[model samples]
Target: MASISFWTTGNSGGSLTVRSTAGLRGLVEAAGFTEVEDAESPAEGRQVSDFAESGPRSMVDLVRGTGAPAVLVSFLDSDVGFVEAVTPGGGTWEALLNRAVADDYGIPLDRFPVEPAVKEALAWAAAAGLTPDEDLLLQALTGSAAFAEELSSLLLVALGLPDPS
Candidate 1:
């Protein structure tokens, strides 16, 4: 069985969307994906404030432990279409994420999606017609654990929508 993961860019375009997260999770489940937690990040010693840093850690760890093939819902920040090969060791961060995209998103050698995800996330962030950058993207991406902190931004897009990036 494959352990499928949907890695969102948090709030694409600067809007928080929980429904979007749920939508993707639902799709992954429909695709027969079992939710596997990731690994914990190396602590740097500070106030444990952000859930984004920790939430995915457990999931990452679980996937590594299971040795299950993964499908990453690609929220790629760039334009490389990386289809993954799940090797025996199969424990590298990039490998696991690539597998999640390739195995789950079904990346092809010839055709691949654009990087840096100019998807709805970006659109949502561009409310008031303001352009968002990578720094803003990271902040919006981590604003919440399961939803965008701001809801009005994603009035059109659902939180759990599939990766259109």
Candidate 2:
């Protein structure tokens, strides 16, 4: 199966500004990742980590630098799955799949509200010339589909991201 964890924000309309290999390099570099490189599948619209080298703090900084809403999906392993969305207005929301693991580890899953993130995604969709239903965004952000990568792919398509395959 094709699967990986990464963050993606919308692209400028009708352009590859933020969804192409070059674009991702630029975005990450702009976000202060000095030694950025294409992900294993650059067409997947993700840049491999400076986050791993620099720490999670770098990832947080990268998202904040976007100045726009962004979504992150992590499904690197069977026992761990996470999704997060951040709005331009500063709202952040997340869902933890693999609840069983979270329970086992005693991790708190609910950290913020979902509605605001959905609203932000809607607003972003409008700005990007895409129109996905609110319920779809809601479900995508919060649903427990069998696989996190599957859900991530669905959300990307719904938000009108180019099919990275």
Report the number of the highest-TM-score candidate. 2
Which whole-number lDDT from 0 to 100 does residue 157 have in model 2?
61
List, residue by residue over 55-83, the lDDT tens digit for candidate 1: 23433332343333222322333211121
Worst 10 residues of 1 by lDDT: 45-54
TM-score for each of the candidates: 0.20, 0.53
Error of 1 at 110 (Å): 20
Instruction: Give the TM-score (vs. native) of candidate 1.
Output: 0.20
Tell me, by lDDT, which candidate is best.
2
